[model samples]
Target: MDTTGWLATQRDDGETVGYLEPLSGDYSLVQARNLLGHPVGGPTEFLEAEELLIDRGISELAERWSLRDAPEELDGGVVILEASPDGIVVAHADLAKAGVYGRRVHVPWPDVDLLLSRETPAARET
Candidate 1:
């Protein structure tokens, strides 16, 4: 995405966990998006937003997700194997089973409908 004015938040090891976009005065919007590119946090104080991302870490991105209207070849739940500004790489969850693996698909960032896996606690609550 166009992160023109966004500030990167990093963990102790210098891994970028997320970004903070400055809003009004001291308020900022957190960009700790899921695999679907949906923000997990809303507008809040800049420090609060930063802390949220730090506390959340990058583990949130490892959650399972399902692609909406995906091709028939990819017929089941997937996990984000890799992600970058360019795109994301996902593999069928079935492939990860029994230590058997298969090809991964590269999808444009934020272009596909990536819903949190229904099995996730957050999705269950919603």
Candidate 2:
């Protein structure tokens, strides 16, 4: 299990900022979050997180969504992919032809929580 520390950033008004997983141990959370938007104005703690999308098991989601590398038109709906430590390696079928696949979409862990309706850990590199 990856024990990387992630700073859950939020605004002073309680609006969620995002999650910051520093690439190094000596990183400054204040500076990173400040550049992204604002300084983390909330509690800082270490939490063990896990990736929601595992390698396999339940592949299809009622034809409404599919994995990133799944075949095109497999579900006839949105295909969700995640960013690796480097970036997005594969993209949805529709997005591939548009020349936008493989591009990393930087998203906060909180926003991802809302999307998946549950908090998930950052996908760690094997």
Candidate 3:
């Protein structure tokens, strides 16, 4: 029997790639690549990396934003703390009331660029 609850797909650079396939338990790292749209590595390598991300509670959808860890919402605005070859780390809180926790999630460079393009006031530097 198929225990499919949800399916999540996304276009990273441009190609439509599979992100989450609950029925097959696949978090596809093969879908995440440089702008050129080439597979990052062999299928086995991609699978291993995908597994590690999921084990850390970073769902396939979350991985697009490079969320390698479980999210913890905080009380503040979105701030880009760091950027590296791997990804950009963003500290952001939900738009809830004050006195709440913020979330620190790692987003890949591509996604980071996309977010920065939005240019929200809260994300502005002080």
Candidate 4:
């Protein structure tokens, strides 16, 4: 997302947890995705939006996600390696094999179809 004018919200430790986007009369809470941005809540009071991000934003990143309408090799399962304003770098779940062969791709953030995975990394560990 374009956050050229958004106000950044930071944790006590000075880590930016999210951003407060200025709207007409309210602010939108956009969670920080490894320096990238993702809207999670919006159009609320500025303080509320900031509080929401501080409380929930960081934990959200731990959740696993999958891609839709992407190449078959990047579809089944993947993990976000890094995210920037330009795009996100994702690697296939079969990292032990595929990643070894440099199976990573950069896709536009807005164009990516990010879906919450039914199975999380923790679930896969078990």
Candidate 5:
């Protein structure tokens, strides 16, 4: 149930958000709920997003940095991030962005590598 992974992502600035989650296995966007400390629903790239967080430590990274609320488009990814040594503040939303008022998943840097969305982010960027 508990494990670790990684998501090597390049920010809009071309910076790296590496080493994020500690949850192992590739989960769907719904499984992202596990790493994100939240729940996810349909049409969301849960597994894809989860893997990236696991690999990049994007969730634990958020614990160390102050992040801006990237546009709440509710796409299938982490939209906002502020940099830190541990990782980066990864802001993710479901496809519909349909959780709460914010609908954002905050993954602490250390645990991001464990997320399920790793490959999706890679394919997206490439």
Candidate 6:
């Protein structure tokens, strides 16, 4: 398989990241997310936006709305990544909604963006 072409997401199966050590490869959906926002250390979950759109989420008793049942117009984007340190980043148009407290990714102190990505350990690199 052309590992270089795969996105950071496709490269990961809950363990290893699609790591190209040279860092010359173009950005995929996942790499783009990593570059544009906060860092996502190690393995993480990658969910299609449509998948989440269909799930029923909790809301006030007086208010009930199903992401799946919402009008077609409500659904957008190809994917949503739950990255480490960055939380839930809704990526679209090369932009993501970061700074949300929805999730967490272990980062290098306050300056996460500067942390370099290394190949995960053999045991964890699935």
TM-score of each: 0.73, 0.27, 0.27, 0.67, 0.24, 0.16
Ordering by lDDT = 1, 4, 5, 3, 2, 6
Model 5 per-residue lDDT at 103: 49
CA-lDDT, candidates in order: 0.63, 0.33, 0.37, 0.59, 0.39, 0.28
| lDDT of candidate 5 at residue 8, scale 0 to 100 | 38
- True-structure RMSD, every candidate: 4.0, 14.6, 13.7, 4.6, 13.6, 17.7
Model 3: lDDT of residue 46: 48
Per-residue C-alpha lDDT of model 1 across residues 1-126, encoded as one tens digit per residue: 555566667879998777666565444444454333556576677778777877878775566667666567666666677876667787776676645547677877654344334346565345
Would you list the rank order by TM-score, best first? 1, 4, 3, 2, 5, 6
Report the C-alpha lDDT of model 6 over 1-126, residue by residue, as the tens digit: 233343433232343222211224332123222322323332223343212212312111112111222234322321233333333232221123433323222333222343322222352235
lDDT tens digits by residue: candidate 3, 1-126? 121332323334433333332323454323323221123334434455344334433222222222333344522344445543346566553432343425556666445235432234544344
Candidate 1 weakest ten by summed lDDT: 110-119
Q: Judged by lDDT, which candidate is best?
A: 1
Clashes by residue pair, model 1? none
Q: What is the C-alpha RMSD, rounded to one decimal, of candidate 6?
A: 17.7
34-101, model 5: which lDDT tens digit per residue? 22332322224544654454454445422322223334453445533444443334544332234333
True-vs-predicted CA distance for residue 9, candidate 3, Å: 34
Give the winner by lDDT: 4 or 6: 4
Clashing pairs in 2: 50-121
The residue-by-residue lDDT of candidate 2 on 44-102, one tens digit each, is 32221111112211232212232333354332223335423333223343555466554
Please report, as a residue range, the 10-residue window in candidate 4 with the lowest summed lDDT.
25-34
TM-score for candidate 3? 0.27
lDDT of 3: 0.37
Q: Which stretches of candidate 1 lie over 4 Å from their true place?
A: 25-36, 98-101, 110-126
Predicted structure 5: clash tally? 59
Better of 1 and 5 by TM-score: 1
